[model samples]
Target: MNPLYSPTAERADNRCEYCHAPELVFNDLFKVEHIVPVSHGGSDNTDNLALACRSCNKYKADFQTGTDPDTQTTTRLFHPRQDEWSQHFRYEEEIGEVQGRTPVGRATSDRLQMNRAAQIAARRLWMQLDLFP
Candidate 1:
């Protein structure tokens, strides 16, 4: 068994940490992503791990920081271990954007490209299922 899988999955209740989709339904398609990539000196500890859907994981690969393309400001990605998700982001249904008011939130949203077309579509589905917050 992969050590990264057990605790990370459990921490998220077997759901995608980002979107909170049930893993049983998304099995084999979900991945354990490092909130801070190892390449950026992140550790293998549980604090650094997050359960992400395949799409999110692939999109977020090896990125510890990013620039807000809209504002042209650089910021660090959201650290699941150090930062609270709710504190950094809010969902806006009317515009379908994950509004980030904090540096942590804005950076993660930008770094992960969280508001991409596909992610927006996924969020809509998750919203219909009452899986999104």
Candidate 2:
């Protein structure tokens, strides 16, 4: 496990900082990921780290920016430490989907594939269990 896992996870309230997926439902601990990858010249500073789910981490990889589906313009992914969840994204309970409210949110949602069918299915289940937002 990453040495920063405990503190990062705690700071994120045991949820993926990007997708807001609760860690409690997963068998594996959520990853402590770089908000900006080292390959992109990011440091290991706490502010640069975020807790991420397997899917989000995998999809995000080393990229920091993505094309906003709506604007068709490049935008940075949501910065957990700098951006507020409510300001960027909203959870639609009826559909178990997360809707982006800003460019960063939209790009992050698309880059991370947050609304994939599997994610929606799991979100619905988590909602039923009252474990999701």
Candidate 3:
């Protein structure tokens, strides 16, 4: 486990900062990920770290920005430390989907594959159990 896991997870309320997936349903602990990759000049400071699920971490990789589908322009990904989740994304209970409310949200959603089929299926189940937003 990463040295920052405990703190990062706690800061994120044991949920994925990007996808907001609760860690309680998973067998493994969430990952402590860099909001900005070291390669891109990000540091290991707590401010740059976020808790993430495997899926979001895998797709986010080293990406700092993504193309917003609406504007067709490059936009910075949602920064958990600097951006409020509700300001950018919304959970649509009916579809078990996270809807992007702004350019940053849209880009981050698409880039992280947050609406993949498996994600939607799991989200629906989580919702039914009252374990999700």
For candidate 1, lDDT tens digit of each residue in 40-116?
89777887788887766776788777776667787887776677777888878866678677876777777667788
Q: Report model 3's TM-score to 2 decimal places.
A: 0.98
Model 2 alpha-carbon drift over 4 Å, by segment: none
- Residue 12 in candidate 2 has what lDDT? 92
Over 16-87, each residue of candidate 3 has an lDDT whose tens digit, in order, gives 999999999999988899899999999999999999999999999999999999889999999999999999
Comparing 1 and 2 on TM-score, the stronger one: 2
Measured against the true structure, the TM-scores of the candidates, in listed sequence, are: 0.82, 0.98, 0.98
Q: Name the regions of candidate 1 deviating beyond 4 angstroms.
A: 19-29
Please list all clashing residue pairs in model 3, or write none if there are none: none
- lDDT for model 2, please: 0.93
Q: Locate the minimum summed-lDDT window of 10 residues in model 3.
A: 3-12
Best by lDDT: 3
Better of 1 and 3 by TM-score: 3
